[model samples]
Target: MKRSAQPLVAAAVLAVGVAGVFAILAMRPTPEERPQVKRAPLVEVMSVEPGPYEFVVRAHGTVVPRREGDLVPQVSGSVQWVSPALASGGFFGEGEPLLRIDPADAEVAVESARASVARAQSEAQRARRELSRQRTLAQRSVASQTNLDDALNAERVAAASLREAEARRVQAERDLSRTEIKAPYAGRVRSADIDVGEFVARGTSVAKIYAVDFAEVRLPIPDSDLGFLDLPLGGGPGGGEADGPRVLLRAQFGGEEQMWEGRVVRTEGEIDPRSRMVHVVAEVEDPYGRQLASAGSGSSTPLAAGLFVEADIYGRRVERASELPRIAVRDDATVFVVNEDNVVRERPIEILRTQSDRVIVGGGLRAGERVAVGLSEVVVDGMTVRPLAVDPQSRAPMDANQ
Candidate 1:
């Protein structure tokens, strides 16, 4: 009787546990359904305006002199005197004497040549007088034909001697003049390696100098960029037309940023073998302060030699082209534009020119179109976007934050 009652009690306990589990499950509430929502991407956009645009090509190179020459001595002599401006880094005017070699020897040489010339001239005069006498004597039959011939020969010899003497005298005078070293042009001395009493030989370098009126820089341009610049590749100044396109050079000097104005003067004869790039020469006038006084402009910083600089060559203008920010242009020559329905679509563009900060498109874009300049995420065609317009004057974008 006790065993039978134990089995019935276990069965009753299992039924009560199952009923409690069902009651807890029924008391819990179900989650409510929510509607699907899509949010549009926010982007900064600029209006596309087709008009005439001046393309500028960028390049870099080192500053060099338009004209540089070695100061070579023409006469061999000991340095007798040195000008104060003959030192390194000294400034000089054109035709100013920089130094003087010992003129004592040169003066002596010139005097000796002059004496020889005088002697030759006197001999020539004596010969002429003798020839005249011979002619008269021959006419009277007192002098033979042989005597006339001898007189003619003597006169010819004397004249030759005079001519040789005159040539020597001229050379001697030139040497004497060469004893003084004069500046060939207005420039600053790059280097000086001589002093008073120092012996120098002819054809030896005395100094090095460069013109201060203008400076030159050889800018390397890629072959693809040649079409944009109207460079004088063959040579000359546009057949007497206006000067080449204007250029602006930038470089750091004296711990501050500086800019120098220049123009495209010419291009190198051949392409660079290694880079396959065409080298263009740009010239900056009044690199120093010398020309400022004449132009009625204040003195400004000069573009010194060997300063590495960046150049911008302003090229031909094109009409009916769309110019947009560089960020708006995709790597595949495509741009994201906001259509009338505020949807971003990828459109193919005919790229006319590309620059560091901007891109010019020749086709597939028109005026009154809005181009998305910057996007926060990957974009697809027909994707809805919230565009923030940019002001042309301030170049700032107007958005919710603004």
Candidate 2:
């Protein structure tokens, strides 16, 4: 009994010691300290500077010739000669002979007509002489009135015959001239259907050609973008060709990038039924001219037909417009602008235009104010933020690491 009582007293003492230690630890005073406030989140920002900005409308289209036609023959005969430049991809000038038909038949017909005309002229002269003689005889009372009438009738018939011969001679000359097939304009041959010694009929297509004087591209502009462009749509009041907006076309040619300058000539009269888009025609003059080929650096190439290209239409220049990164504008047309105290305040902004990389603000921003760009955290109105200011000129981030 005594040993059991001693073990219980020892266990009770250990328990009391452990409880006392915990109680002392809980009662002990710690060093006095103050609570800390959370630091503001760091955000990169850019200054809002409203200034002159040139609006550019981007579009794409296929290049095509301004004038395309099929070369047809006006006169038919066996081909006597074919110009070397009458093949596919050959270039020729206006009125240049592309082919010559055998002039044997036409030449013979012309000679026959000429001889008949000569014979008719001689007969008409003889008849006139006879008529004069008959009139003199009548005045001298040597010829009867019936004889005078017969002489007049013979003179009239001879004059009609002479006119008929002259008409036939002129027609023969015209047919002879048409034996030489000529190019109607300065252009490049797209194809050829005939060769030397090959017979062709009149009004048959010989080749396909397109004028190289100018080219056109039909660009589809969205209805929303129409406000940004001053196109001559439906001949509406958008200004004349002399003061039309300029367009720059870019494309890959000969394994290199090439650029061509053009102008907005006109727009489609109505919206396309399928796309509901307005197509504007841009004209590039002298597409094949050496001056145009050398417009850019490096060896330049011509803007050939059927080439796909991108176009940049120069639009109106907006003055004092605020330009901001796309991320700065929210869905509700509001931006997080950093106030003077470095606190983010949500402010409404008028979006004049939206581009691929930036947004043009028409109002609600000052020249020197800072707007938060690319904030990683969820933004709240009137949230205090540490703005890492960005230089307007260099576009470098300031206090970025904070």
Candidate 3:
């Protein structure tokens, strides 16, 4: 009975061990239970457009009066009165009186000259009567020829004295008239340096005036641009022109667009020593009283003297050049162009001109080629890209990868 019990216990222990081994095998991991990795998303991008480009140059310049003059008193006198409008930044018309100098002294000189002329005239009349008497005595044989000749000479001397006095009087009158300082041309007064009761000397500057009929804009072009500029090689209107190149100038100021029709007036004859640029002058009409006034009136728009301005000189327009958005151009003058296979090709370009928002390409681009606009990424040659099609109606992105 004990032997039978022992066999029964051994069988029960073997069954328990087999159950434990099966549980351990179920909890262990296999090769197929490991975690799997996720792939990154593709970078969505836009397309590029290609076309003709142009070359352009930019420069800075200043505005100046077409005609400027200094107001100087020709005659010396004490200042009697100054014009109510005579001050810095004043405007006046042509021939307007800017200041009045005391003319009393000049007038007195004139009067004294007139008295001298009168005295000389009286002496000449007495001499003529004496000459007549001498001639009669010589005819009657009562006087010698020498005595008559002496009398005639005295009369001639008196006549000469009277003419001299008359000439002095005329000069005195001219000096008196000059005591009033008048404007030389129609313009605005830049400054009035004299006032009432101030003593002014001859040839002293009393004021400064600038003509407003027209204004001048000076542009500095590099020596390289000299070939494209149609400058007057010879002198003509401003000097003279012997059939030189002609350039068109378009000027914009204060939100208003103005077209000034003029040719290159002249060059500075030499390059600037400091900037190595040649100064070119262009004449612009100030018809709206923007630059100057007819009389001493201030400018309505006040294009004051020495104002800086931007000038655009229209060079030869390229008929076949393509226009592109400025952003399409890279720093190395290369652009991303989409080929027929939708692969981006980085094509090198030559920039002709860069306007406000567009660039004109001169080389390495043809008309009607698709180019990228406003792209901000590192684009390489033959890179696969999805071009976002642009909607013609709304100018917005229509679809991705079109």
Candidate 4:
């Protein structure tokens, strides 16, 4: 009976162990039943059409006076009055009085000189009458030849004295005119150094005037660019109308954009020793007179002397060069062009020029070809790309903050 009971217990234990193993096996996962992760979508991109574009070179430069002149007092005198327009940045016309020095002393000198001239004229007339009388007396033998000679010498001396007095008078008048300062050109007075009651010595600066009728822009180009310049016919860099090269200049001052059309008038004739750059001068008409006028009190925008500016000199434009967005060209001078099958091919390109947002490709690109713009790291040569149709207005990428 004990043997039979042991067999039944063993069979029951074996049956329970087998059932537990089956249950564990049923809950275990198979290779085909594992979880899979979904991938994020590729970044959307736009395409650019290649075409002929203009080439431009950008450089920085300074705005300077077309012609600047210093107003200096020719005669010394105390300042008696100044023009209401004599302040710094004041505008005036040609021959306009800028300031007035005390001319009282100059006037007194003029009067004194006139009186001397009158006295000299009386003496000269008397000498001439005596010489005539001596000549008549000598002819009649009433006067000796020596007496006639003495009378003639006296007349000549008197005539010399009269001429000297007249010259002194003219000089005195000129000095008086100098006391009244006048504008040398039609321009704005940059500065007035003298004031009412201020004593200015001779040759002292009374004011500074600049002509805005035409303004000058001095551009320093590398000596290599000399070939492109149309040098003046007879005069080297700075002379002759032939030296002037037609150029377009756009200027901005105080948030207002101004367009100036001008020509390269001349060159500085020599390259700078340190910079190896040749100074090219271009002339533009100050039509509105804004650049030559002072702020608020003038008709045009005030272009102050010595203001720095950005200049764009239009070089030769290649008619057949391929132009694309700057982003389409990589740093290695390679561009990724999309084939008809929508496959990207890396093509080597020769960059002719680069403008602000565009680049001109002189080689390795054909017209009407689509180029990838703003590509991601995943995009490479021969990689498949699905370009989304980009809206012209809404193509800009959304910022992360948005």
lDDT of 2 by residue, 319-361 (tens): 7798887877899999998888878898999999998778899
TM per prediction? 0.85, 0.82, 0.64, 0.68
Pairs of colliding residues, candidate 4: 231-243, 232-242, 232-243, 237-267, 290-300, 290-301, 291-303
Residue runs of model 1 more than 4 Å from their true location after superposition: 1-34, 40-44, 240-242, 293-297, 325-334, 344-346, 355-358, 374-384, 390-397, 400-402
Q: Model 4, 182: alpha-carbon shift in Å? A: 1.6
Q: Which stretches of candidate 3 lie over 4 Å from their true place?
A: 1-57, 115-163, 233-264, 287-300, 325-337, 341-359, 363-366, 372-385, 389-402
| Candidate 2 wrongly placed segments (more than 4 Å) | 1-34, 127-157, 236-240, 290-299, 390-402
Alpha carbon lDDT of each predicted model: 0.87, 0.87, 0.71, 0.73
lDDT of model number 1: 0.87
How far residue 147's Cα lies from its native spot in candidate 1, in Å, is 0.3
For candidate 3, report its TM-score: 0.64
Count clashing residue pairs in model 3.
Answer: 35
Which digits, one per residue and each the tens of the lDDT, describe model 1 over residues 208-254? 88888789999999988989888887775676324787889999998
Task: Give the better candidate number (2 or 3) by TM-score.
Answer: 2
Better of 3 and 4 by TM-score: 4
Compute the lDDT of residue 160 as modeled in candidate 1: 99
